[model samples]
Target: MRPPSRSSLILFAAVLLAGCASTSSTQTTPGSVPMTQDSTPLVGTDWRLVSAPGTRAGATLSGAGAATLRFEADRFSMRGPCNRHTGAWSRSGDQLRFGGEGGAVAGTKMLCPPEIMARETALLAAMQQPLTMEFEGPFLRLVAGDGSAWRFDSRDLPPAEGRERIVQVAGQRVPCTGAAPMLCLQIRTQPGAAWQAHYGEIEGFDWQVGVEYVIRVREYTVQDPPADGSSLRWVLEEVLERSP
Candidate 1:
């Protein structure tokens, strides 16, 4: 058999080089990690912002009024320092996108204080950017393309089927006018709110006059009651603290 001609050899070499280039293009490059198949760690988790570009380190939604992100299926909802906003969200590999103009966020239109409104604005702006996610144990960090980063801590939600809700409340005792003159706990749900009378009494709690208390109570709805009676019952779970 005769050896291949010089032109034939050149043609074969070109085809071999082209094939190599095509295969290289399809393979993962150096330092590039393939996308993970399991997104279980991210979904169904409640993430509370702990740090952000302009916010203090270890900041919390509850500590700074209220801000939280709950992801479910293809959507997400957040309660900012003042208002609640929700929009669609999608994930591709490590990239996450929050809906923007075409997928505008709809929220409650409650007028809030200037400071709270400002925080909400900043948070909304951050959500509009494209983010890359990283998970570290119970913490999740999102870094935007612009170098803005947000760190969040995981907070597992309680079972939804139960009718009871346990919460911490800060309040004082005040005189209340009822069928019989009585004392009521004047509680404030958030900061900078006027103290309002909580007509319901804390079961198993012995109220001391003129004292303030930060207490945890289990509130449950009454199955049936008198038409003029309160439908919710507050049972003292624990006394967090007491003050004058």
Candidate 2:
């Protein structure tokens, strides 16, 4: 049997830990929070970091934010270096908030690289207050009170009209270094070729993790772009085959 995904393990652990905490606590648990209209976009969603302003994305030592934030029911967990930090969360209007022990996550610690350790500390501190939220399709950006924003996507991305090619897409998305810690597709040009992480968009195609695909794509040179941006663009022309 295949192993469970990181998300499944984190979720299972979160659920088990949350249940234990609730039963063991003597303090009054907050009453059932009424569903808020503003939270519809976030609830039951798993957001992976696409970029962050303060801490560098793809930084092995760069710290400043959680790579993944999952909202399940009224509770959530943010994946960190030392631990998976779990907390209570709520949204109202333009703000989303977290609840924790004494304004910090409660957990045993592990030693990591000094820089990573420090970033983890800063990341937890940043979450102590409320953050504003924005969304565009599969992408979601959460901005802290200090304007240190974290951008995430749980996929817009037009078709290209240049040279066409056939590629095979893997069944899973891997963590890649793009502008940030990216959840990207693994694709290869030849049948026996090693898969390479694709950080660009596949225009006009809806690609899902755990689904393998053979596709036709058009490639073109990107016009003037930022120094760090991709020089070439690939747009989806046709999906030749899909395997569940």
Candidate 3:
């Protein structure tokens, strides 16, 4: 095509830019519309803290403990570095508020290292404050009134997929009374649950008798079948805690 005169080219460029601007204004960008409290994707989703105010860029939960949050059914559960906290949550537009008489932000009594405790305290304090939430794709940003910002990644698992369950067990090895008797890991799924003999080996865990352990295990179904075999399997995901 022939080159346009300087003025003509400038006018054409201005028109093109204006058209582009108009198109952009009309088109809805992903996450451009703010989500309402009741319709927010934050509910029933898990978020792993990626960054926080006063932290270095790209800061994450790389220490001994994880900083995570899960919002479900008007309540929130958070694991801050060391302690686990739970409370009620309410949102109005972009503002999120935490705590009420019975649903105050309460944390576990477990003591952690000074540094971890400090970080946990900071995170808990931020949650207690009212914050504005913004979503960018799978990422979420929360900004507090004090100008502090927190970042989290949307870590929602598939609907069909099962989640890992963490259970504290008073570990012991017992003999499996089967056709071929073998040693098995005796585990308690919960505090009040009876101890059951687990025949399958938990990967990444070196089981020891008489030791207390907090273990994360993923439950899934197996297709193949064996005589007197259970379809459910519990694969170890992590060892959160262990004590003699």
Q: Which stretches of candidate 1 lie over 4 Å from their true place?
A: 1-40, 57-60, 100-103, 156-244
Q: Which numbered prediction scores highest in lDDT against the true structure?
A: 3
Q: List the residue pairs that clash in candidate 2.
A: 160-235
In candidate 2, stretches whose alpha carbon ends up further than 4 angstroms from where it belongs are 1-40, 56-66, 100-105, 155-244
Total backbone collisions, model 3: 0
Global local distance difference test of model 2: 0.58
lDDT of 1 at 103: 45
C-alpha TM-score for every candidate: 0.46, 0.42, 0.47
TM-score of 3: 0.47
Ranking by TM-score: 3, 1, 2
TM-score of 2: 0.42
Q: Comparing candidate 1 with candidate 3, which one achieves the higher lDDT? A: 3
lDDT of 1: 0.55
Per-model tally of clashing residue pairs: 0, 1, 0
Q: After superposition on all CA atoms, how large is the RMSD of candidate 1?
A: 22.3
Which run of 10 residues does model 1 get worst, by summed lDDT? 14-23
> What residue pairs are clashing in model 3?
none
The 0-to-1 C-alpha lDDT of every candidate, in the order given, reads 0.55, 0.58, 0.60
